[model samples]
Target chain A: MAESFEITDEMKARVGVESPPWTFEVTTTGVRAFARGVGYTDPVYYDIEAARKAGYRNLPAPPTFHGTPIYIPGKSEETFSTPLECDITVDHGLPNTIDGGKVTEYYEQICAGDTLTCVTKLASLDLKVTGSGITMFIQTIEFKFTNEDGKVAVIDRLKVINH
Target chain B: MAVTWDNINEGDSLPELKKKPSLTQMVKFAAGNGDFNPLHHDFKYFACEYLGSVLVQGHFRYAALGELVQTWLGHNQGGRIKKMSCQHRGMDFPDADITCKGTVDKKYEENGEKLADLTIWTEDNEGKQNSPGAATIVFV
Candidate 1:
């Protein structure tokens, strides 16, 4: 388990702060496991010849495979702390949860042997009082993925929720 | 066979996926996803610590939604999907009947491949949206 950061008043003011860029080298094993984890048994995720036949330089990763690079060990930890505005007295129970649900404007397909670099930043944060007893605090974190040629590959917008 | 835009239209709803999440299902998914958060499996933890009975991991519903998408798209022969995004709106306790559904919002060609803009959502027996989002799939 990783150490959790304390949410101070200053840190709370900077809830939507940007972290330094983190780079992850795409691995074949990571790609295969993600596809299989989602129950996709297609050969394109594993068979190199099939990928070549499909116009890919090598076996390509699945669409959702990009999360592996961004969500791995150290890339998204400090960003996982509870935002300052959350009304909860302490942060012990829930995992800082965020789900990115939006259209991904694809610029390029990631083929095998591609080293992807990601630049992540906290985009926005808001606190709203629901009519019910629950108070909803939402934080948006955006991550941009770029390939070896410095071309943008994908953008991931993750919305974190604390109630 | 390549899927064409003319072959489909907007407001086309795919078959709904009916599933009941069991404790075993939650445990398996939690294990597979490396999320052992007790909120998913620990009944006492949820009842005592979090004020719930038994809950399902939100990602499990996303995976089920993915299943519904693959089945709707008629299998992407060799073409790979570009991306999928899902917004989770509600929670699923154990033994809850969850259903997944989607509609073809539009169709267009991108980079020489036929693509579909699909708007998808999931609902439970009581008619609550569980997860809502869109997926851009290149039809092969």
Candidate 2:
């Protein structure tokens, strides 16, 4: 069942309102496997000492690692399974939402041994019916990551276009 | 390390980047980015629903721009990207070759730092702009 919503400017305005904080732990094996899964061989993503030598406090997860959790919503806890990066909205009966795009500013380095809490909120939604008879709803979502110190490490604005 | 700034006027083009869209490359991106969103990997996902065929993930093309910035500016070493944004203008289907592109719209000094105002995008097999965006690069 594909669920459809009436997208309006008000809906876009309602985007980014934070939901309950989703807390998760990322391990070194998790980071390495994820990096390998993505074809990124950057040692900083897997090797702790390498990351430390690279000036990162701990083995750092890749910039898009935060995306995995957001995409899947709720699924597995372990690291190296079938990297299920599917969108959670599908559970809501929505199909794939294309990312119109995003603008990411990496403020602080995310290091290993740090348990980060990801806070997500609905940002906005715009309904566009293409000339080709396809209806694309552009939904914007925002994610914020806070470390134990309450320092906001990363703020990501994700734009997803789903029908 | 600081990004070297040259006098780039409006209408200047950055070095263009070329790539091919492949299922194997798509899988690599899925593995590296950890974004195996099935819509990207499963042909049936597309065949049965949208587009009637598999399409490249939008981010994969944008990643090419990120790669260009890394290759040219040397990753985080190029000072700060400050702000960057792009939109999906078209689609790049599988097995099609494409190119990543950027242009210097203007150059100026801000907050005592040199900056380049630029536009970027990816072109599909037919030489059409697929993903387009603008960026501000600050040099130390």
Candidate 3:
């Protein structure tokens, strides 16, 4: 048996607590790499002329590109946390961590050169007793991404499972 | 030949899209995605902590699914993908053969726009599902 942390009531109370905003830039270099990395062949995401012909200002932020973190130039990479922002290390001594799921809604298109700011919070925390007699806590974190124009571009809800 | 609104029906299955993303692919994706997390490429940390040799980014899998859907719906100018959701069921290690498969859940017309709902996912070499998700695409 692994050492387990006790889930405290205080930890349960921290649900819905919002974290600080994370700001990042959408660059063409990042866009092309991201597109090709996933084997994306859309010319709009690669060739500039193709993009302009497709009616976008430039390479647009691929659908889930916001999920990727931006490493600002001249800044320490360690300074910024990964996209999964919730601190799972609470009093609860959960031994294993796993990603549960993602629910995302896209409102407006995010184009290259657009600056984005993401504000996230622990949206919900729930404890369940499973068939295996194990106590599991499912934490849902919500991320709000706003474009430079101050409009909501994408809203993502991610669920984390700790057991 | 673009997949138009009138061509396909519900219960139809999309061809399986498979790939074993190379290390070069992961690195390139990490560079463009702005994610330099050690868990992605560092074998020691990933094995010790995440119980995997090297992990593929969750969004990386999503990108593959996106491409699969776009290819199925055809890259024509009229189709628009409105939303997609993913439920990560398990971890995918580097160089593992992952296959994507899906079925057209339903088809309908909303305000004159033809649309199809797809239930999709990616599985590991063992055929265990890693990411199960859904996508909504509007056809021309």
Candidate 4:
């Protein structure tokens, strides 16, 4: 638990610094899994034939369902399965964190068989104290998903609250 | 009938999508999203113990709201989501109803594409808006 917290100059400097690019893959099985996980009954997310008939080349990724990151043992976060290299680590001493929110912007339709090169940047950092007197660090990270053809397909902003 | 820019009007409400996510469903979401965070599943995890129960993944609600929009769009026949955003205002527990709702805020033509801006959210069983959001969908 964080008794007190403040943003350091070093942490502030890390904002806007882009991390090394990582690969995120959109696959038929992955889209199906995510769609099923979300309890979607839409056939376009499960059957390629239905997807094609619906005007998609392959199974379409459902809303808010971005491609999964390529995970590598020893270089990935075991708990989250995210590439460790893409993390903009802040030494905020909070031990617990929660998802505060998310914002996703889509430029192109993301479908199965597409590989997106993703880059993340720390967008902003702020410190807040809750009504219950808990100190928290709010960090917003921006992710850019660029398709194989080099066109940016998606931009996601995720806000994480660490307390 | 498919929803089109010509038919959709401002202030229209989307058909509500209700969900009651079970623990097993949460596990499936964990596998699909690769977020094995114990706080979401392990009952003995510190955060879960501190919070009194396993909390639902915020993304789960976000995606639920997305599902609400997709269902209204006739599963791609009406249109596609161009932008979606949400703010998690409070924690939600599993096995409880999370009702997704939205209202069309505006409709306009931009750069030859017809688009509508919507105010979206997921409310708990008590009618408390736990996750309030906004979305933009383009008519195909």
Candidate 5:
């Protein structure tokens, strides 16, 4: 909890800055792992035959399961497995963080055997103080995932609150 | 039967998806989503200790809501989720029932496509709506 916090000019300048593209892979194993994690019993998410019968070229990624980022030893986040090259650093010296919310818009069906090039941009930043007198820094990041054909398939807006 | 745009009414309620996530399931989610946040799986993590127990990841509930929509749409059919959004309002602990429910709010067409907008949410064991959001689905 921060007693006093503000979004400085430097922080505002970070908005709209696009990060370098990173590779995200949607493999059969990745799709099945995500399906199993979500407790899905749908065979279309696991069986290639079932997926084909359902009109999908391959195992379909679950609605919210964006493909996993290609992980490298030092270039990826140790915990999240996200590529560090696309991370926008905001020098907000906050000690605590919380998940504010998320919005995902899909333009195409994401399936296994597809490779996506993902880019992220700092969309916006705001500061809010609660009635308890604790200041919070709210950051909204936009991620765009484009498939091999250079078509944007998924866009995700993630909100993070730091206090 | 599959839920088609023609068959679903504006006030129709989707079948509820009930989830009871365990510690092992949490770990699997951490692996599946690549979010190895210790507060979700490690009870001894400092944040978990502060909260008195390991908390379920917000994305877990988001994915469950996705499952709810997908199951209703019937994967064998050609329905697609055009958009889905959610806000994390409160913390949910593991081993508790999380009920995902939805109600169709509107039905319309755009550029020759049939669409239905629905309000969706997940409720904890006490019936408190912890995650509330909306989704738009397109029918073939």
Candidate 6:
């Protein structure tokens, strides 16, 4: 027995709407902790001199470190737990959400002190079938991060399923 | 530790890397990375309501894979990860030794810089792939 399904008209209209771009300032502690959290012990990710020796102005973030939204527009850290990374999410009243996958492409370096802007848009929503003959809805969202100088730094594409 | 262009070849393998992640490490990642998804923690929420046990996060696997690239290619070295992607196929727990491996699928020259495309995947002790994907790195 499966649960009931309902998608409100408001949610459907929200599709294709991009949330305002949010900005996150890269920091050393953030980078070092990000490196350590993943069990990476490279000095360049920790020490300033090591990073310079490696030919970087400062430590550039590693993959997936920026997956979560670290900043939001018009939000203060003192008021909220954390800044929401600007993203558009369509809630179609589908209780069973699925994880499809994530694709990340890097262009410029996300060095320390570089303020990056992240803009997200809903790409698609479609019906998918599972191996067990279950009907599912797939939602794909895309986010592009631009460096301070306006050059593209990275683009993260995420896909999820709603059942 | 520069991953010079001349030292790599097509079909070469990036050295394998393994990580025995701990609960504390996962928590730290959640706190630092700003991903406080309840699924990654909250014992009761994980055990009673969710996937039997607290599933190790997809970010952990992705981050570990990133570490493998940085450790092998050297982060500051001219080798920059142009693109890295992962598709989750299975659920993984925190208690397992996650093994990450990659193979150089092809090598070419782009914009006067050497580049390599890699086929990368992560598996558990059971040899079951939890996440599989591809990455392209450029060595300048």
TM-score of chain A of each: 0.71, 0.69, 0.82, 0.95, 0.96, 0.80
Clashes of each: 0, 16, 1, 0, 0, 0
Instruction: Compute the lDDT of residue B70 as modeled in candidate 3.
Output: 62
Query: Against the true structure, candidate 5 has what lDDT?
Result: 0.91
Best by TM-score: 5
Angstrom error of the Cα, residue A83, model 2: value is: 13
Residues A20-132 of candidate 5 have per-residue lDDT tens digits of: 99999999999999998989998999999999998889999998988999999999999889888789858788999999889999998899999999999999998888888
TM-score of each: 0.68, 0.71, 0.82, 0.95, 0.97, 0.88
Rank order (by DockQ, best first): 5, 4, 6, 3, 2, 1
Which residues of candidate 3, in runs, are more than 4 Å off?
A1-8, A67-93, B46-52, B74-76, B109-114
Candidate with best DockQ: 5
CA lDDT, every model vs. true structure = 0.63, 0.64, 0.75, 0.90, 0.91, 0.75
- Decide which is better by TM-score, 3 or 6: 6
Please identify which of the two predictions, 3 or 4, would achieve the higher TM-score against the true structure: 4
Alpha carbon lDDT at B33, candidate 5: 90
Docking class of 6: medium
Native contacts conserved, per model: 0.21, 0.37, 0.57, 0.74, 0.74, 0.66
Docking class of 1: acceptable
* Of 1 and 4, the candidate ranking higher by DockQ: 4
A4-104 per-residue lDDT for model 3 (tens digits): 43456898777777876777677887788778888777788888888888778888767677645654454424522354343432455666666677877
Q: For all the predictions, what are the DockQ values?
A: 0.29, 0.35, 0.51, 0.77, 0.80, 0.57
lDDT of 5 by residue, B14-88 (tens): 999999999899888888999998889887999888889999999999999999998999874757899999999
